[model samples]
Target: MSRLKLALFALIFLAACRTVPPPAQPHSGFTAEQQAVLRQIGFQPKGDQWEFGIADRFLFATDESRLMAAQKDSLAHTATALVNVGIVSARVEGHTDNTGTARHNEKLSLERAAAVADALAQGGMQRNRLIVRGLGFRFPVESNATPEGRRENRRVVIIVTPEAVA
Candidate 1:
């Protein structure tokens, strides 16, 4: 009886010590429609945000904030897609290479972000739904020591949040 009681106690203790996985978090950010839109616009998912690289139709000229004709068309398509997906708001973050002074980079980044935001607005997205930010050379995805990396660093990231979709 004593041996049986000890075995039962051990079994109970082992069962109590068994690990249980935590509840799964509900999916956030991009909805199905939004994801479709992102795909259509050629935006790649980078973690929580979406990136439109220079390889896509969203390239910016060297040290320039003006959108090229192709870039404008891309923005238009993106705007239409965003509307279709019911995504009412987005945060546009502009980044640049570390070649320029911090102040200059900041200003240039802001200009680039504003240019993109304006293009989106013209494409039919409401101005109120867009928030522009210039991060300058603060967040570089690659080392700025290489030309390719520098080019990659000069980019605009569109961040979609649950609140934006909601």
Candidate 2:
């Protein structure tokens, strides 16, 4: 009877011992000011979905040269703002009007995204801090049926987030 009681007590003690996962580490990237912008922009880290943005003025440009300048400036500002807060990495997504062919638009969108990424790098962002993507006309914010709306739809969005620090 004594042996059986000791065995049960040992089993219970062993069962009570458990290994808990380490707590989530603090995010290490953005400055305080930039962090505020991220919070305002609704950047949540729980899921795969992240928020990005595009400028209204950039879409109104008629020539590629004009578009390039606006895109560069926009991305630079975006990166600066994010880095200031704590963003260590970002993804730039480019969108365009439906007036062009799919292939042409696709290439143009990628170029636009790359241009933005370059601008971000110039603004003190690191080389590995960015990822560029071009969605073309497939993901339009506004209807492409009208010239005005199409212009508004052509843009690049920057998604910001901090690097993983264990």
Candidate 3:
């Protein structure tokens, strides 16, 4: 009886001694420092991509692709951050509200993207690593029916590709 009791106790001890696996790390390609820097500068993580953006009103006047002086400064700082972190590839995309013909919007959005890409290049990011696109009303973040929604739709998005931080 004593031997049986001791055996049962040993079995229970073994069952209770399970080693829990370590906590799972986030599935992100960026290092902790890079993530911190991006988050601090208003970039948000979407899966493996990091995105930063602002509405068109803040950066451009009505139908104008030229970025304001202050907006240029802001984007330069953002580009500097990317260069500092050794980001290898980034895409600068422009979007516009559906307030005009698709052809017009497409041209305007492309100009906007080019303007932003130029700013980043001026701030020391390699020109070759920058990809520019003009989505034009085709990928609105909000409805075009309301003024507020239209404003939201007129924006630029910068996405750091997975190739970044290499």
Candidate 4:
């Protein structure tokens, strides 16, 4: 075959072998690092907006009014990007310090998830694409025996699943 024809044949063969990237793998669930984020958020997602609380976890609490502060902007961006790429649905889980009663922790976790979800929304995600849940003291990253452990236990976690995006 002529050089040009040979080149064309090779190109066609390569193109035929190239398949659409397999539909992205379904999200298996949260990773260890992401679970660490839950330790930071202090809650977990059971479904949509409901939040459960974990007493023995440490979570960072910030104001909803300033939810988009630079510190969390990168996370917001990443989560949004994943959603935009049709890779996953965003999950915001919240938790709280064990400084309060079980009821209080539950409520606090829900608030924290809502706060993060709000930040994500501000970053351009549709509200329907967000799932928020709070787990109060039901799941602990560390034992709540000591003050430090308690501090570590209060947190919120974000879990993204690919199935949502598909």
Q: Which lDDT values do the candidates have, in the order given?
A: 0.78, 0.67, 0.80, 0.60
- Residue 166, candidate 3: Cα error in Å is 12
Best-first order by TM-score: 3, 1, 2, 4
Error of 2 at 30 (Å): 8.5
What overall lDDT, based on C-alpha atoms, would model 2 receive against the true structure?
0.67
Please give, for residues 99-149, the per-residue lDDT of candidate 2 as tens digits: 779998888788777777777788778867678888888988889889877
Residue 87, candidate 4: alpha-carbon lDDT = 34
Q: TM-score of each candidate?
A: 0.76, 0.63, 0.79, 0.56
Which runs in model 3 stand beyond 4 Å of their true positions? 1-24, 53-59, 164-166
lDDT of 1 by residue, 78-148 (tens): 88787777876778888888997999999988888888888888888897889999999999888989988
Number of colliding residue pairs in each model: 0, 8, 0, 34
Give one digit per residue, the lDDT tens place, for model 4 in 47-144: 43213354422256422212436636755665555445453456677765566678977887788777777776666776677778888778777777
> Sorted on lDDT, highest at the top, how do the candidates line up?
3, 1, 2, 4
List residue ranges in candidate 1 displaced over 4 A.
Answer: 1-26, 44-57
Candidate with maximal lDDT: 3
